[model samples]
Target: MAVASVTYLTRLAGYIALRNRTLSPRIVEVMEAAPGCVLISVIAPHFVSDRPADLAALAITLFAATRLPLLATVVIGVCAAGLP
Candidate 1:
């Protein structure tokens, strides 16, 4: 698949580019924390919005997320948001 190929190629490129390099402790720490930062950046705004529907859906999603798999949590969020 195209997605798989792109993912593999990008990883290979990164490996080739970083070959024989020693990363500093700070750089390694940043790399480890980057995904959490990115995830928060994506989700933070949704949590702070003034809309009731948005808040309700996010709350339901957060609750479901604690007890369910990711796919089910996402589905619950989608269905909750679609409620009339």
Candidate 2:
């Protein structure tokens, strides 16, 4: 219960803080890129560890991301990761 309250209050505080503010276009563009940046941060270590499967998967996913839908990219990535 205490954890939940803290989580809720923190989120609420952020919402209240941003609710009245108007952000610039550049900030909004950066915000849009934030998820991909975070995802790369999380995945970079795995890529740097010299794992062939992960490298293959990332390559396949990158290619699919450019040519296919999100769901297809994910499916191809998972399949690539399972490759031996």
Candidate 3:
């Protein structure tokens, strides 16, 4: 739990720092969207049996949250759960 918290904090800090860098608006938008996407992907069904899939999902979730739309994020999360 401690390690997980630390990792989360570190990722958040990095996210903030990246946001502060003032990239193009398009880039920023994408960045914002990435986390949501990744989160959805992470929780996707079939995520239980395959470690590789889990990692991929986690990466996607992180990526989507960085720039993905909030609505899309929620939808993806919901959809992921339903996936076989």
Using TM-score, give the best candidate's number. 2
Give the distance in Å from residue 6's predicted Cα in candidate 3 to where it truly belongs: 8.2
Worst 10 residues of 3 by lDDT: 38-47
Candidate 2 lDDT by residue in tens digits, 1-84: 664566556556655777788988887676556556656665678767687777778888889999999898889887887888
Ranking by TM-score: 2, 1, 3
Q: How far out, in Å, is residue 84 in model 1?
A: 4.8
User: What are the per-residue Cα lDDT tens digits for candidate 3 across 34-69?
Assistant: 656654564465445566655555556556667888
- Looking at model 1, which ten-residue stretch has the lowest summed lDDT? 2-11
Q: Note the residue pairs that clash in candidate 2.
A: none
Best by lDDT: 1
What TM-score do all the candidates reach, one by one?
A: 0.57, 0.61, 0.36
Per-residue CA lDDT of model 1 for 23-42, tens digit only, reads 88887676556555656666
By lDDT, the candidates rank as 1, 2, 3
Between prediction 1 and prediction 2, the one with superior TM-score is 2
Model 2's lDDT to the true fold?
0.74
lDDT of each: 0.79, 0.74, 0.62
